[model samples]
Target: MTRTLVDPHSVPAELRPYLQELVHRTHSVCGPHLVSVIAVGSVALGDYRHGRSDTDVTVVVDGALPGRALPGLATALAHPALPCPAAGLELVVYDEDFAARPSGAAGYLLDLNSGPSLPGKVSLDPAQSSAFWYVIDRSVAHQAGRVLYGSPAREVIAEPARADVLAALRASVREHSTGAGHLADNRVLNGCRSVQFCRTGRWQAKRRAAQAVAASEERFRPLVNAALRSYERPSRTAAAALPTADVRAFLAWVAERVDETAV
Candidate 1:
């Protein structure tokens, strides 16, 4: 069940062929019920950290497939190189209704912001938008990384949401000042930690080692700052939470931050 992690480049070189084969194989068995198979996660984003990453894939099947046939596909994904044994493979079958409003579409939260897909491409959905936003708000603000898939693979996800993303990004930078035990505990901090950890094992380890420096005082300060910062002036970059009044308020708050920083 344990497979060695493939670097982003190697993943596509190795996994893509297998995935294409899997798609064809699924088509043969399930008939024309299969739609597309997409790859998500670090591999999709291109900013994959070599060793500490796993391939996240989405198998888009046609609605015609019977419920019973799915377990078989799950069983099929488990190989030495692509070890999606049992629970590892998350098979999501989309009906025509769901397909149109894919929550994991190219512009969805994380995927919109990720790098390039190593092997295959995945779609996104908008209903699950909140979760994606939550992850980005916490992760990007705190970490350093890139997207590998969806959108224009070469175009960075950072551009669309730069101002707000930077706001969170700046917050994460400040989070590192305090001793936050693990990056995941803080969204953006975790993203930053993941990027650092992926690149040089020792570098993140070194960064983690310094976590004890500011400890409680630093941690409390950042959290308080984020709360106060986001309170009066919440971000408008959140597509779900934007309106004319909210946008105006958010912009005013952003201006205040710039003014204060300039002073």
Candidate 2:
């Protein structure tokens, strides 16, 4: 049976109209081939911090999207054409085959990373060389994503294997562990979430997972709480840095622990 697409009522009120246009524009591009559009990441997870979380989504098509439709679709949803209200908008489009049975390669028909401040990016490859993250995203979407259009998410998004997810989690820490632009709070909170996911096999909001880490691992409470505060209400200006050494140590510890887990 062919499923109908609708703007999800459960999303944040501000996003309702924006998403309506998103779905409408997407359908116009893909025509009847559009399958589903699943909302994922912080916005879908209910931990969306205004000015922090990006409006992330996955668009699925029955078959491959026509190459000619790419430019128009990308241009329409990107920055100036369709301004994003959140920190930015991150959207990926995949055909039904890959959406139903994902791989670690991170192939996509279209990948858009548009933000208000950050430069816009349109990619067809794993531009950052982190294909595994897309695989992990599919897992998160399958488990916790909300349906914004077309079929129910689970009906299209197949969960990636546990081993693949854990592997990706381990790889993910490297970028955040030590980099010029890596934020202190983001590193700490991300580390906590990685640890929590390893132990529970669940996808949790960064703050919730940080709280759990603090409650159980008292050693990291101070760091976790600090990060939580920053994440909940991010500052417009710079704040005191969380010790880089400490954040790196925690992430390394998380990677080791994740590697040890039975996937």
Candidate 3:
């Protein structure tokens, strides 16, 4: 049986107009170079919350955009004139050639995270560069991503190798596990999702993954519950409520399990 895909309109009503405008502005900026614009992550999974989730987008271009075009696109996306409703906009721009055959190395043309904190500011961080993010995003996009422009996501994105996905998850967990705030939440939840993927060969949103893990392993229930609670009601106090030591132990345990199954 053919599976039904999540509708792009499943994104929160308050955020839909902003996403539409983002696509229109991107099309205008990239012009003929534009290949596709896709929405991935929670939004694509139909698990997005208006104030907590981010609008994760991947813009595919025909070729590497000119240096001048990079700043122009950034300015256009984070311009004070175009406001976003969610926590922020996490967007990455990729070249079609590279996306079609990713090298498993850091080579994304542009990585942007913009929000209301700095309405007119668009900070570009090379430190945020990771082939893992691209690879994982590609896999998610292929499976459940919503196409906002150009071709269907499956037509434009290649399926990431299982080994590659595991590697990316490992790297992600390691990198984000060091912090106590939002990173802690990300590490715990994403680690659970990674463990779920390793066991089931299926990707799930963090909340669902946490629920699955809790259901399967009684010992992990408390940690998963904490993460889910924090995810649902994100705040400084909620983040602080998480048991840091338990989160660390969970990460280590999940990482070991993932490594044991690595091909």
Best by lDDT: 2
TM accuracy, model 1? 0.37
Q: Give the deviation of candidate 1 from the true structure as CA RMSD.
A: 14.3
After superposition on all C-alphas, the RMSD of every candidate to the true structure, in Å, is 14.3, 2.2, 4.2
lDDT at residue 182 of model 3 (Cα atoms): 49
Local accuracy of candidate 1 as per-residue lDDT tens digits, 1-263 = 10112223534454555445545555555555554444444434443333233345444444567756654554444443344321123223334333333132223211222112223212245454333333232232123222222212112212223334334333434443342432222332233333333233212322242242224235333432332233223222211222333323333333344334333
Per-prediction TM-score, please?
0.37, 0.92, 0.88
Model 3, residue 161: distance off in Å is 2.1
lDDT of 2 by residue, 17-83 (tens): 7787888888778887888888898866788776677788998887656777877789889976887
Residue pairs of candidate 3 with colliding backbone atoms: none
Off by over 4 Å in 1: 1-11, 79-91, 102-263
Better of 1 and 2 by TM-score: 2
Q: What is the lDDT of residue 144 in candidate 3?
A: 87
How would the candidate models be sorted by TM-score, starting from the highest?
Answer: 2, 3, 1
Give the lowest summed-lDDT range of ten residues in model 1: 146-155
Badly placed stretches (over 4 Å) of model 3 are 1-8, 79-81, 117-128, 234-240
lDDT of 3 by residue, 1-263 (tens): 11122244656677777887888788778887888888998887777866677778988888756656877898888735568777778888877887786345545677877875322334344445667877888888888888878788888887787888888888877766776334466677888888988898877888888889999889889878877777777533345356778887888888888898795
